[model samples]
Target: MRSNHSASRVVWTLTLCTSLALLGDSTLYAVLPSYHPAVGIGVVQVGWLLSMNRLVRPPLNMLSGWLSQRLGPRTPYIVGLSIGALSTIGYSLCRGFWPLLAMRALWGVAWALLAVSAYGLMLDVTVESTRGRLAGIYTSISYFGGALGAMGGGFLVDALGFSPAMFILGALSIGASLLALTLPRTQHLPARHVAPGVSLAWRPRLQAWAHALRRLDARLWLVLALSFAHRFLFAGVFYSTFGLYLQQTLGESLHVGAAVIGVASFTGTVLFLRNVVSVLVGPGLGYLSDVLGERSRVLLLGEVLGVAALACLALADSLWISAAGVLLAAMAYGIVPPMLVSWMGDLTRTGARGTIVGGYQTMGDLGSGVGPLVAYALAAAWGLSAVYGLGAALCALTVPLILLVRSRAAGRAPLAVADHGAHGA
Candidate 1:
């Protein structure tokens, strides 16, 4: 058994590690669409490169979960961090569509290993009483790396060009991997069975997967749906297209007095602002959900805010108005993720939680993966505003589903956050 203080340290360390690992990935999001041609890719290939890692994450998520269950989080976490650093290095050196695509896919594998292990480890060490706050803490600190990555990466790219910027960040990522060596070798002891004569038993390779699938109930299904919808719009479409949209609306460079801001620099600043808001609100909103004793309510409000933000962003022709939309969107991004993960914590136990979290993340990955492809294709056909409008509509459609989950929870006996019964699925 772990003490709260020890668990808290673990959560913080894991979060910080992930934050560093994310430097390359988030920086790419900030610079890629605009710099696509600089890296030997056409405009049409931009979305594919942006989303390739995500597209490969679904299966990798499952693999990460199973590995976490069998070997504990420490090993995979270290390995993932190493891979992430290598992939960043690859990004710095590689050119052309195929090479960049391969690096993106490699990053996907890294994320799967890091994310599932972190979530599983958090659950293993913390209780219901501490889960929400720790989750909030995890989210808050995790985005610090993203915030820096976007802002610094843009400045670096603008000042030193793409390869140098990436190489510098990749070196930093290697430092993060070294930091992981201090973590305990085994966080969650793998469950084992021993019997007098039961050596004759047989277990299939995918038995864990089958069991995880069988465990999904209506509430779990709702979690998956919410994860899918939220990521599709927020991380997927919005992240992939926001730079292009900015270029279209604001032009290649913005001249404010003596200062000239290129599209990548401006995009990075906006992205940095968005992530700063996420860092600021992630913990507070998570604590709010804990205080309210209902993650669903907080999530519902965030979803609605997402709808409004998208609409605002779609129509805003002025800078301040667009900033407002970005602010709202940031709040939505911060609020939804921790609450959704905590809600999953509410509905699951340690035994099945790893696989279940994997499933949830896989759905999110699938949505994010498909989102960039769809958004780019649609934006080309119908214009960026229409694509934003479509995102708003999709966000709006998720509201009723969240309400249903809230109502169902209200009508039934509240599921205990730390319930270890066989009810988990």
Candidate 2:
């Protein structure tokens, strides 16, 4: 029991570290587009600068996973946080395309390290009983960091200028790095022998990932597909286009039966409220899964909500109705992430956990990275409403996948899949 308490404390501490490391990244998003001139860049450069981090993450995530497997989570986690701190500081010091571009790529490296290590650490300290709840806790706290950074960083820049605000954020990131020192220097790895076809190199090989893929059965495959779809639609397509969607459908200002509200304000509020709902609901949903001893049921609820939300957005004409749809969308996405991640943990063992997480992150990044470009292209051919309807249809498609995974689980000796094909080390 005492060990459980200590482990829980460690999870909480790691969660805080993740939140602090996110400050500069989230702040940059809020600050860059509006203050391009102050940062010594053109409006054209803003999109590239913002996207460079995610564009660089796929390979880095694989590498981060390999590192977590080789060196344990502590060293790499601290290194990532230190790199993030330096990158945050560089944001204040560097200017122009080349220099800031390098910083953004370097931050990408840091995030890859941070994400995988934190995920690996969570797996290290948790059991099947505790995984869902702790995953929720991590998601809730980490999101709070992003929300704080987006809002607080903008406020700081307004009050103290960009350079000072960045410097302060860098200092906070350093503080988070310091906290990581409290974690164990080396975590226990469950398997003594490397899984077949997996390499020991710093850089992940395609064959290695291919081997990992071959090992996952249909259930895990569905989880990975859902991860991609979730990010593609919510993070990539919807967020990038929603503001424009509002402008097109409702005009620059939302008319609430004679009450006037700026579209920009309305968009920001809805998005921020979406984050707020995630922070509030993330843990509760995770806890519910833990109590029920099943994550797919909760995941199903989220998917249904997503379909309903997107359908509402596609058809609704009123402001309040749109807001309701946004809220539903928020709950939908908020529920999926923690539940899915925890579900993955439940279905995999510790030795191969990092690699599995790496694949999940890679898919998510690809989805988000590719989503907007494809969405806009599709929208041009079709329309925003049609694109949204397509998204709803795509979301609904996941329901069958979930039921398939659940049915597969039912056909086995309950733990057979988790213990052997899917969860084996």
For every candidate, C-alpha RMSD to the true structure in Å: 4.6, 4.2
Kindly list the per-residue Cα lDDT of model 2 for residues 199-318, writing each as its tens digit. 677556568767767867676787789989999999988989999988897788977787999988788777888888877787788889988988899999999999999998888888
Q: Candidate 1: where is the Cα deviation over 4 Å?
A: 1-3, 27-50, 89-103, 153-168, 184-215, 255-260, 411-425
Cα-lDDT of candidate 1: 0.81
For candidate 1, the TM-score is 0.83
**Cα TM-score per model:** 0.83, 0.91
Cα-based lDDT for every prediction: 0.81, 0.84
Off by over 4 Å in 2: 1-3, 185-212, 255-260, 411-425
Report the lDDT tens digits of candidate 1 across residue range 108-221.
Answer: 899999888877766666666676778877876687776676767877998999999999999989998998887764434356776877563356536864785686666778
Check candidate 2 and list the clashing pairs.
Answer: none
